[model samples]
Target chain A: MHELSIAQSVVEAVEKELESQPGALLRKIGLRIGELSGVDPDSLRFSWECLTRETGFEGVALVIETRAWQRRCPPCDIVFAVSDYQTVCPQCGTRETEHAGGNELDIAYLELETP
Target chain B: MTQIPMERKVLGENDRIAAALREEFHRRGIFCLNLISSPGAGKTLLLEKTLEGFAPDRRVAVLTGDIQTDNDARRLARYGFPVQQITTAGACHLDARMIERHLANWDLSTIGLLLIENVGNLVCPTSYDLGEDAKVVILSVAEGDDKPLKYPGIFHRAELLVLSKIDLLPYVPFDIAAARDNARKVNPAIEIVELSSTTGAGLDAWRAWLDRRAVH
Candidate 1:
């Protein structure tokens, strides 16, 4: 699975973001993953564990929040959650609804302690 | 522990690299496309057919990736154009870094169309952007019609869905209508092109689709 690669990238990004703060103890990291982002949260956590084992980043916890697929209809001016993979706007039967999200993968927050 | 509200993208490094590649492509007037599919979904064959149709002087090149062999590159290079193979070792997908590395030696200014055949796993490839103008996902009739529904990630992200090996539709249990419908259910705006690299059927439409997108 590519989750290992993803986990490595995420860890690297966090490490880079924390580089300026000397002796910053990164205690936890929060992730917001979309359903259609092609990342499995559980698998990512496992990968994170494998990457952090015995490293200086050991014992760092991971928090994940998942987002569902969404669609927004311009004419109806309504945002709707997608169900059963249906993207059509429920309000106006609009077929041109834009994909609002369901593919965003971001780091929501980082819990750390400065030594 | 203090919780700092980061709201940063985890794959920001990859995104930054892809953004740079996109800028370089745009600056060089290059039209790039990333082709993704499951293993044995006729990606290499489709590229073979596509490369065959190009004129000898056409400023088009290909970069094909696989977990191990250079066989795909060998196959595509038979058309007398520049084709390179990226062996990812065990990686299931090709990230922007792999693409940037392989493209280091190429004269991008002379290239107008650059086609990248990603490592053949639909799921992982969908997550990595290669700075292409569009993503094209290919599925063959040999695979189930429910493939699009099963792997909605790539289907939703791709701009065009190329339905390959359509000539085998009569021999197989694959339903073309159902496949198209499932793809549309996930992505209403995804374009579909049905073709067979073997019998040369529907290749014109595929070529035309490329022609329309390969703006100089």
Candidate 2:
């Protein structure tokens, strides 16, 4: 699956950060994975462990924060959480809803060793 | 002992390489396209038809990604074209690092159109970016028009949507308008072209798009 590659990318990202800060050992990686991001967190974490073995980020803990999709109804001006990609709001059935958030996959912060 | 929380994305490494790959492609004026679709969507068939059309003039190369079997690669190799097959062994999608690893020693200079045919899957492939100029998502009539609604992420991310197997549209209940409407609902700006590699229906528009990209 693409999770393997995403895992590989994560390993690479940690290693690159380690390169700059010499004698740095990765402690934790803070990742924000949205539900609509199309990434499975379980698979990603498993692949991360598999790919990070023998690397600087080996055994590093991953702190993943999940983000849910949010949408706003254009007509009602009501912001609500979208469980699925439905345009109509639960409060009011209208096709005037716009996507607000919940499709982000970002590495927010990294914990590294101190030299 | 308190472990310092070094929060960072592990994909940082691949991002750097991807940036480099993008720069390399841009410097050489190479227009790369990543073609993705479900299995039996006629991706390779479409490629064969398109390649045959531009074979004599355009310097085109294909890198087909699959879990096993070089059948697709072998089929394209007969045209005396450069084709590289990357068998992922079990991976469902193609990644940037895999492409980087195999592109060595190849004459990228002689290539005009670099087409990367990703393994057949709509879900997993959309998550990975292989530094392509555009991502073409192919959908056939047999796969149901509701595919766009079911998988909005792929449609939202793709630059072009090729509606293949149009020749079978009359036989099947594939509503072309609904498919286009759904895709537009997700992206609202995706370029769509309907064609059949088997019958050569509406291929000129497809060729024109390719030709336009090839020169620019």
Candidate 3:
């Protein structure tokens, strides 16, 4: 699954940050996954648990913030939040559509502590 | 033990590195394109055709990523162009760090067009930026026209959308109009090109777009 790759990137990123403070232990990591990012949050959480079992982040928790998908209608030129993948215009039935948001996948923050 | 709230991003490190790579590419005047699609969406075939269209005239080089097999690299080698194979082993997508490592051996100065063919995937590749000037996405008619709606992220981020295997459009059940419409639904500004590598239909338009891009 694509979650594994995202998980690895998260781990590597955390590791890089922890390198500067050699005595710090990762406590938690936070991420924001957009609805249209194509990343499964559940799978990423599972993968993170599996990879951090015996590592420096043995007990680190993962918190994910989900963002909703939004779209802009070409014919109406109106922007709206898309709850689903259907492209039908809400105000007008025009099929002309453009996704305005909900495709972001990035780590928002990470928590660490010095032992 | 107090919990310290450090606003450190988990991907912060990689993003910084990716930014550096983008700057380096800009400095060298190299335009890198990251080609992404499903495993059999005709990414390699399209690249082969693109290389044939503009090779020695433009000093083109390719870096192809696959789960396994150097077949893609081998295929491009016959053209006598600079090529590199990045076998991800089992990874589904290519990341910026991987490019940073392999890019060290490449001579970016002599290359006008640097194409980075990402691992065949419609999902994870959308999240990672490989320091490319643009992300070109391919969708084959055989894969169904609804793919753009199903995988909207890739289509939304793509600078250009190529509809491959158009020769099979007549035989297949795919509605070309619907596919184009759906892609526009995701990204209205996306440039769309319909082509068939087998019959060589619609290739001139594709090449013309590349010519315009290379000049710009």
CA lDDT of each prediction against the hidden true structure? 0.92, 0.81, 0.83
- Which is better, 1 or 3, measured by lDDT? 1
Where does model 2 exceed 4 Å of error? Answer: A15-28, A45-61, A68-103, A110-115, B1-9
Alpha-carbon shift of residue B130 in model 1 (angstroms)? 0.5
The RMSD of every model to the true structure, in order and in angstroms, is 1.0, 4.3, 3.3
Model 3 quality (TM-score): 0.87
Can you give the DockQ of every candidate in the order shown?
0.84, 0.35, 0.44
Task: Provide the TM-score for each candidate, comma-separated.
Answer: 0.98, 0.81, 0.87
Better of 1 and 2 by TM-score: 1
Q: What is candidate 2's CAPRI-style docking category based on DockQ? A: acceptable
Better of 2 and 3 by TM-score: 3
Residues B36-136, model 2: lDDT tens digits: 99999999999888778764766788999999999999988877778999999998988788889888848889876789999999988887778888899
Better of 2 and 3 by lDDT: 3
Q: What would the per-residue lDDT of candidate 3 be over residues B29-146, giving only the tens digit for each residue?
A: 7778999999998988888887787647668889999999999999987777898999999988888888888888977788777889999999878878788888999999999888
lDDT of 1 by residue, B109-187 (tens): 7799999999989899999989999999999999999998999999999999999999999999999999999999999
- Once fitted onto the true fold, the runs of candidate 3 whose alpha carbons sit more than 4 angstroms away are A16-27, A71-79, A85-100, A110-115, B1-9
Top candidate by TM-score: 1
Backbone clashes in candidate 1 total 0
Q: Give each model's clash number.
A: 0, 16, 1
